[model samples]
Target: MTAAVSSAALPALLGPHCTVDPDRLRRYEIPERGEPGKASGLVVPQTEAEVASLLATCSKNGVKLVISAGRTGLVEAQRPDGEVVLSLEKLDQPLSFATPDGEVFRFGERAAPAAHADALAAWWRGIGAPPCEDAVLEVQAGMAVDAVNLLLAPLNLMWPMEMGSSSAASVGGCIANASAGANAVCYGTAAHLAIQAFGYSGDGREVLSDAPAWKAVPEDLLAINSAQPRPEWGLIGTQGVLGVITRAKIRAYAIPGQREAALIPVSDMPAAMRIHAAARALFGDDVEEFEFIGKPALELVRDLKGDAFRSPLARHDAPYYLLLQVKSHKAHIDLAGMLYEFLADAVSLPEDQIGYAPLKALKEIRHSITEASNARMRALGGGRLSFDTATPVAVFGDYLKVLEAELKAEYPDMALIAFGHAGVGGAHLHILGSKDAPVARHAKALVKIVFDVTQDFGGTFSAEHGVGTKWGDEFIARAPAEVRAALIAAKRRHDPAGTLSPRSFALDRQLAG
Candidate 1:
């Protein structure tokens, strides 16, 4: 039998950290699309003990939980549908940085390192890294990605992941989603950066990458001695179905010394691909980010930002635009000069059509595409059907062309806006329908069209945003048999009772069958 908790009994059971108040509960209800979720209560657990206790109670009673941090997820994973919301926001603090050998640097009382040169040097040496080289950070899961970078900024280091929602995306959420951003082409995804994770399994057992007893050892000697591989490796991209990540160690990199960016108008996807290839050939690893923006998406940005947002390109009528950025850590490297030289020599665009801008300005325009698309949908009194899809880089240009053609032909009234990490063959496609033909009415058909094409091109249906409840059914039905079986087996092994994120990927339904 499924267990149910009463609102009145929550406070008595979970202490002062639990709340059933509607107003407070509303904060965690907001979802990216569809109706906002409703929950019985919200629980804020500050430590691993509290999280484990709550999970134990839920496991024993068969009450469901939805793990949430930052509430910035695009997928419906965080949206609690009558289940209790277990929030890790209270655990938002840097714990300690430990090397592979177990040397720990505690950031007690202060989240960031001391500002003095001596203190900074001490931190660098403690991690056994040269000044401004690579390092690792141990932080609570609730800590925001942007906050992590802020703490590392003083040390001339960074976590290196860039998300449109970095300011609100939590460390745990990034790991759960295995998120990749525009710069993922250069730095890789969250799974690549995370070294170790500490969390509670769905059954309330302590699941840690390192030894629990290591905490009692001298701080200098706290290292991993386990003969078995870290169990947290399986939990990284599982989206909290297996466990709730409380703490993690993530790799950090020194800030690049020279960074340069350019925005160039292109005739179409093929032209954009040509320029992308040329940039990769010329700069190699120095090519940090290469992004594509459809004309409709660019127009939305220009219209929404109004007169202040002028197009960098001479003409705004181009079917596509490419935003290219290159960076180098070597202080003396002339990245801007080399980038300009490449543009002049390889790009066939007229001098007027090619435009250069600061990296920050160019990223701002790229990041604003989602906001603009949402605004357009809202204005039209219709909802949006957004997709995070990817294909092999070799056929990425052709894939987009086919997708655009199929989408326009089937749903001509729907405005198709496209943009994403072109360097990595990932794209975010949004379809906004007119009031006369609402997208909500054609949601399933639209999804089928996109997913079918994605399969044809040998691409992923859900690339970085994970398959939450929104796409769970499709994932189960359409994902390869082997992949589905593997995920199901993992889910069964880690969360047999389906106590955590029961709705995600419809694990409960799959298990029931």
Candidate 2:
């Protein structure tokens, strides 16, 4: 399966700086595996033409290819199994904003953390509204998510998606994984922000993009491109099955005013639900985020670290805590009392109700605790476990209880963290544990248990983080048969020779089922 593509052929395939090194491929493929040993040889192309040429060659010779972006991918999607790797790392091109007089006020730079800040430099050029009439931000696919945000944030603007691994994860990686962050409560996932992408087909012939013959198709692929295939069960349906994302047009703008936040303690799950109900009744539009965390999740954050982890409860009786956020604190009454008092008074009424509150200074306490605890968590150990699912906001009440029962049965002694946009019915449920646990079989088993329970309630198996090679075959088979069929069809349309990434979409034993 390993072929030695001649060194002279590579010069025509990539930019001046690009190379094809066996060692580099080894590095890119290592991290994604359970043991960092699954990666294969490398092919780093510096330009889109080179990328296209590489794919064309793969097609002609029947070579399997896996694309690597920022290298922060959690799954083994990019873990090449003796296949050629089409690296879009050389696509780090910079974009900018300015006057026609050549008075360049600013520019959007596309470089890794090691490079200079570019996009934010341009963000400051025009924060009110961008000029240049339909000026598209054509960021090079190799840029990392955090670098993009830092570039925009100085001007109070931000890139579309945010992942916990943003600093190390690349823009293309975010698109491939359909990354989401805390703000996904208001803004959507990467899939929503990704407007267009410049990709190549394995056939050596260009197939699609907004500008191609299939111009009728929207760049966002919102309605699904008949010419292209979508992923069956998770986001980034195109990561492996389709071609690599070399360039993308994304929505970028100013970050809202200092986003206001609060951390409040709830007596029970119902108490947390009550707060969610009253908030929806009040600032339905302004409320940007609503997150919930159980005592066990917090207890783990505290146990691994210390007392700094945010906790509203001194006593273990409450069982959970609620973290709510607003764009502005324009609520008329005392914020805490407004939500809690209403819950304790009127809102609680069976299936029509949510958890109520004893929250006196909910907002202030929540912010203070988060600010205090997050620091401790950083000092200790653990990345945000950040697993999430969403159902109809109406059915979320019923779903949460079922989700809890499922977790208790499967993940006892493990810390489970749940929070994020309850108003939208999407919740982030992460399993807090030692990094050591991430490599353990027990932890891997729980991911399935959590997904099974979440799926039975009619929730999508994945909300933001796309399924990569990390999860097992059962997870992919769990999806509906029609969906899988469509996904495979999409894969074939783009990567017909099965020479792209085999790991991105698993079509092994569960193929027929």
* Candidate that scores best on TM-score: 1
TM-score of each: 0.90, 0.72
Q: Candidate 2 at residue 420, lDDT?
A: 49
For 283-338, candidate 1 gives per-residue lDDT tens digits of 87778888899999999999889987855676788888888988887788777778
lDDT of 1 at 157: 78
Model 2, range 178-212, lDDT digits (tens) per residue?
A: 55555555555565555566666665555444421
Model 1 RMSD, rounded to 1 decimal:
6.8
lDDT of 2 at 305: 45
| Candidate 2 colliding pairs, count | 23
Name the candidate that leads on lDDT: 1
Model 2 TM-score (2 dp): 0.72
